[model samples]
Target: MTSTILNPYLEGNFAPVPDEVSVGDLPVTGTLPRELNGRYLRVGPNPTGPAATDVNHHWFAAHGMVHGVRLRDGRAEWYRNRFVQGDAPNHSPNTNILAHGGRLLALVEGGRPPVSIAPDLNRMATWDCDGALRGGVTAHPKIDPASGELHSVTYLLRPGSEHLRYVVIDATGKATHTAELPVPGVPLVHDMALTDTRVVVLDLPVTLSMAAAARVASGTPESGGEFPMRWTEEHPSRVGVLPRGGTAEQLRWFDAPRCYVFHVLNAYDNPDGSITMDVCRYDTVFRDEYRGPADVLPALARWTIDPARGTVSEQIMSDHSVEWPRIGPELVGRPHRYGWFGGIGADGLHLSDDVNRVRGGSLEPGPLVKFDTTTGEISTHHFGIGRVTQEPAFVPRPGAEAEDDGWILSVVHDAATDHSELVVLDAADVEADPIARVHLPRRVPFGFHGNWIADNDIGE
Candidate 1:
């Protein structure tokens, strides 16, 4: 292993691709399903040049890019990658991408509002539900399939920012409800969860650093390039629960473990009035290192929150190192059977040795893992040592009934060739070979969350 203390985010598949290219007729090694006639869009940060050479140079904050592939009637039509154009302050939304309310949105946390991009992968303007949305949004919002509405719990990631916003937008691109819920401190509310009856807010331990904020304000040589958020014991880790469409006055806070959760797998309201949440739990992040993720990796855990008794019971479903968890698109705010995740570390998010020989890398991910939440069963698919797999998104088969009846799509990077491919694996048989692989001409850097936007869903 390379023992050098290099920023792992800037090397290997985590490295950014220069310039944008549009290529047609990408080669395919297997047959493309005729029913799959939509664009598979994956996005991540791709710095225009080199990132800042400072301690604050983090993977979370960088220029955004969206790589897209179009499929029509089982034929690979085209592939394109474009830099998401944004010059406004706090508008660099380089985290996640999805289609909602008949529009495409590139998302980020904090005061940066979601930016609207065209279906062709070009930059547009900062969107706000046609003025129904009054403020910023979250990258990880849940879309209700039954009602065709979007529910989000967003917060301002600024120094001394002390409140969270809960916004609900309807199917017609209009905000129906919005409220500001108060929190104790400037916690890093990266992700949130939802159920049919209530919204789950993760008021965890990671909060803004006033010292780091001073560094940012000064712009001095001593404090150049610093990410402002860090883990803090001063801020208690609490899970705030509130009824759907309710105000901050109704929010009931429940105490939780001193942990951080970047992504929530799925949540549901039990018949007994308790909320069940499955999440990727991290022991701590941004503790020792201020740049990006380090220390202990995340494990799959389930938290049972009982508002009636004001208690939460935490259980580890598995201790495997993993991140970027996903369920069936329609299963948001509902119970789910299967969850797909991207693996990390040797087992996941742990130091390989006492010498600490490695940092985080795109090559460190182990497999595309599938967990049966009901039976405590696990299955995984690896693309070998050098070929790293990012998040696996599940696209359900058209008119499918079974929850696991879908194709798991992911972007896999091959280090030997320095290129990426969109691999389609059968969710029923995840350990099997890819059902289809669409080859790209160049490498796609390992980044963040994405989804398969069916033409029908977006009215293409």
Candidate 2:
């Protein structure tokens, strides 16, 4: 990998797009080294703070306006910009959450948005989201264009644990219906994903040894058995698909892998009203499986869904380990391609050998990758600077003929300084260099998930 000592003050384009295409060329710019780059901080796979929902990568309809907050100068700054717009709120929850169309779409069991933490254990809340409500529109809401309704999942804390309730809301943020969901072998539900006709809930099983269980009863640190030591085999992963209407019956259930984050990449509704979800299942045999925090298990196999019968089929297109799976727009009558930054072993943060052969670390930034379902071929576009990256969101060009063909918008992290930048890529071929890079004046504190909501769509 090419290594360059990062200049804390050097700003401008660290690496500019190639004037000419080459397999191993890195971009260079003369801009002053701005210390405000995002490379200085690190955000883990699990998003911290506030309960927001509906974080689908491709959910935003357009971008005339966007609203959210960024942590800068050790403080939270609320933002309302015309970059993307639609009916989205700026409130931050205590857990990880985001919504589309005024609905609490997907839910994660982590810290909420609008949070502040320091090295000395300083903690403070900047915003308040009413996540404790059970049957109403949750902290985040997801709207289903096909069904013309907002979908939400609510969790109710009860004796010993919490149970979930699904709620459907109208466009006006009014709850229309509510139903209980089933999650066996799991005591905690981290996040829930939705298909047009079905809902998939990923649950984490509680495995406490008798001793730890007793300690929990005695209000003491549960010693050692609070979590199971079973690394790979039969992880606490489980998936459930429930119909959207007409009895809201469960159509299928599949075992899923334990994900570092709760949200599913994406699920599609099949012609038969069944659902398919792409998930990363971690195997138990890998001795190094429990490397990081037990909650942050390394990702393994990728599986496709068959919600009609509640089953999952693994797709072996790429044997490489993948993380943060995302679905692109459909192409050639097929659903959008699936992709995630990949690696050979644990610590998906680093580039593996397969990526090395190309430009030797030029692809080290863990290129934005895509998997064509029809051809099973993979393509990657890299930012020479190796830094942590998140699932890139595809923003279709205005008046683009095909949804699959458009501009890809992403937040890239620079390894040298740990700063992040908003980069635009050509969707058709991710291998191409960025079309535009907007450097934030300050570090946009690292975050887990986000979406692009256009302004025209949201009601005034």
Top candidate (lDDT): 1
Residues 169-204, model 1: lDDT tens digits? 988778999888998677888888889888899999
Per-model CA lDDT versus the true structure = 0.81, 0.40
Q: What is the lDDT of candidate 2?
A: 0.40
Per-residue lDDT tens digits for candidate 2, residues 278-323, read 5544332212322112222334344566544556666544544444
Estimated TM-score per prediction?
A: 0.95, 0.59
Best by TM-score: 1
Predicted structure 1, TM vs. truth: 0.95
Q: For model 2, what is the alpha-carbon lDDT of residue 157?
A: 28
| Candidates in order: C-alpha RMSD to true structure | 2.2, 11.8
lDDT of 2 at 443: 33
